[model samples]
Target: MQPVRRSSRLTRNTISAPETAASSSRKNSRKSSQRRIRCTPPPEDSEPEVESLSEENSSEEEEDMHEEILPKETRYENSRTAFQGLYQEKPDLLRPSKKPLSARFLTQGARERTSTVADAGLLYTVCDSDSFQPSIVREFVANLGDAEPRGDGVAVYVRGSLIEFSPSLINTMYCIPHCEEDSSWMDEKLDKVCTLLSGNRIKRWEDMSSKYLTVTNQVLYKLVCSNWIPTMSYTAMNAERLRFIYMLHLRKGFNFGKVIYNQIMRMAENTETEKKRRIILPTLIQQVILIQRNVPPDNSDEAESDFPKLVVKDKKAGLGSGVDSKEPDLEEDIDQAISFLKGIRSRLKRGEYPIQRKNEDSESG
Candidate 1:
């Protein structure tokens, strides 16, 4: 093989000229791309930003809280508690220094899903329907495990169990003590009932009031010495009107009074039932006394006229029965009436009948 000499610079460049032109053409066709850069405001144009007052993020919830019984708001994020209320509170409502409770993230899931334990203490609205959807009832009763009822609070049915004051009040209705709101409510209802009796809103008011008088309003009377009598101690807006209703139509207009009296009368049918006779007589006397007490002194004459004649016919039926056309003020009459009842109870328990009617019945028999 023949020896070859190395090429000079001119010859080398001539060989690479085609590649160089290709590179130049590619460079000429390529476009330069620029990056976006955000610029901060210059120091002269910048001003301190104002922080709007509102609740901090979830991390702020871990702050110290000393209250043993915190308000229900802490559980706002939990879906269970969120559905329990009517509306959600806005975060802006929280004060600048405070945050919601941290423990709310842990909802009462285990306690609810596994147990049928009763929360009898909670106030619940009695939903009246032939059949309630199971899901609705469950939702209504959920998260109510810690509630307790008081002061004219509502009652309802859940899983076939009575909730609120209803369980204690259903059979023994007279035991329901009156409250301030209860009195005002009753006054409004009574006005409605009066309007109904006058033929105004007759259909709606009659049906409603008939049910109300019987089942809805139980605060008007109580049992004492085994007798049902109107409660005299309840505060009243119009004493005279209350007296009139209780005096002339107590057993007639009032639902429970009629039921109680009918039951009492059934028990008192036999002459040998001295105990019932004693209750009946004392109950009548107490009724008179209550009506008398309710009658304002200025209208004593009207009250005396309004009182049933047969009850006061004996003239010595006790409790100033002889005071004609004006029943005496009975504000301090309960104790006296109670004392009289005790005396009657003693006599009856000893097998003595105070009224001559039982002897007459025995003769007739």
Candidate 2:
């Protein structure tokens, strides 16, 4: 009777053949296969398993069907320790091999771009630490007024802080634009960093705790040994600048080598302005000894003199050349010291500079 008067509505609603049953079966199969293909993420209390899918022969249609059956916003996360903000790949999948972590070891143009990302994270970890408990961090979050700037970037100094003398640290954070062809992006990144540093008022490394101090020191050490700045050259810094650097390391119980003295002298000699260089020369020599935690030798006969004892002699115009002249021989002693230094160098080269015996009997006797 129904076949004689079959209506479209009834036909549409009716489960006609075993095809419907088969469809149901297919859906069940997909759910089972998908569950096996991708395991449910482990519960918080449970350890995660690293499992590979065994559905190598699974058809694309079947895969698509499986995807359609799965619900959106699954409560799953990767077992990897990496932060969720960085990667979004499926959990339990095998990661590919990777090269060394060092930028120096990395090949090609990878390092140039990664320099910002990798180092940004490095600096963040540093700047984000809680070591400022003993100090202040300036927070640099944005939109804070009536804030005082405590330090200077152009003339940076650090007291009892090793991170301060890090020229690379300063260079990396400074806002100078990049010189590369694709510097727009790099410059943007640099500008963003520099703004962050400035806005937060982190003019000194002492503003940051020692969270990433190791990396920071290593970077500066490499930069120094390589005779390089990140985006600039190692032109001679003046004595005031060097004193600033020296005091930073000194307070941290750091010592300078004799090479530092030679380098400073070389820079002083290279200065075009003779008077200015002379002024810096004595101060630099004084700082070198002071920072090394060494007492200056007593050169005065009375041992208590107004002049500061250092590598530069304290002899004034009274016992100096051009003493009788009206115009000051502003560089008289300095010039003699320079000449003496040159003589020492020449004698040392020829093995003629020998140690003088203080207790030798007089030639007259």
Candidate 3:
């Protein structure tokens, strides 16, 4: 036998520390003391108290643990609900419940009900339920050789009908490259498009459905009747020559070359034509009316003395003497009118007013 191993303890006070302390304290006091004890109730009366405390601790621990997990899923669900509420309140949302044909406001839902067709020559018509009917649309489609239906139910007919004027001219879809390139032709085009009107075509197109067609045709006829052939011919010729003209000036390194010279000539001719077409006619008409309205009194007759002479005085005097003399010459046109009326009366007396005479005999008999 070897010495048994044991766990080490503090050897100094291990044996008699508690007894020594008690004995020493008793020795110092030398007197005995008596104490009384009072009975009291325990904090809890039931076994369930321990269990309830333990359960509460466990629930608090669980809540703390749960809060440590990822929170994106919860945030995303809340955000989605908020976004849906906002979408419902937006003003531009299309309401399917509204009627299609009421034109006060154009809703996107109404766009679904309307249809369109583009015939030959870039003619497109927008047809809606209240205005352009399906029958008319189909007729327009049939007139075109073939038709194709778009996703929006618009049937586009190709080469079926003719648009009298180019669509580009109406909306400026296709703009002329040199429309404002300091060319007199541009001014002429503007003036022709604006003021020129054909009286005959105006009468003919009075019953036409399309207002643009009437206006454009009237302008076209006026341009033709006024001998605008030379001007338009130059336009057509110059339209083809724009590229060549540029090359001659830039690439050929020529100053005032044949191309440039020709362009100058074309410009001068176009300006003269434009002044005659746009300025002269309108100015002359205005001057004649001014004279007629501000006529001076005649000299001889007392009754006519109060009446003014039909003479137009030019305010821009000495600048245009040629146009000034021609102003009184326009009054000669009135005398010619009187002579024409006399001739018409003489013919009427000889039973030459064929249509009037026929109507008169029919009424008399």
lDDT of 1 by residue, 1-365 (tens): 75554566668788899999989978855442343445767677365443432244332444534434465666555655665453455554333454433434233433331121112111111111122232322322341333345433333333344344222242233332222221232244544444323223222221222212321121221111122333333322233333333322222222333334344334335424453342232323223223223312332222222222121121211122111222233564678789999998888777687466578778999
What is the C-alpha RMSD, rounded to one decimal, of candidate 1? 32.0
- For candidate 2, the 10 contiguous residues with the lowest summed lDDT are 134-143
lDDT of 2 by residue, 195-214 (tens): 23223222232232212123
Please tell me which model should have the higher lDDT, number 2 or number 3: 3
* Residue pair clashes in candidate 3: 144-160, 295-308, 296-308, 296-309, 297-307, 297-308
- Name the candidate that leads on TM-score: 3
Clashing residue pairs, backbone N/CA/C < 3 A, model 1:
121-148, 121-149
What's the TM-score of each model vs. the native?
A: 0.15, 0.15, 0.19
* Tens-digit lDDT track of model 3 for 1-365: 76544533455456668889989888756543443444666676655568889999999999999987659998899898887787789735544465655554466533421211011111111111021122322233233233243332223232233321111222222121212233332223321222112212222111211122222232222222221222323212232232222221122222212222233234434653465432111221122223223323334313311211122222332222121121124476679889999999999999877899999999999
Q: Please identify model 3 stretches exceeding 4 Å from their true place.
A: 1-156, 159-166, 169-328
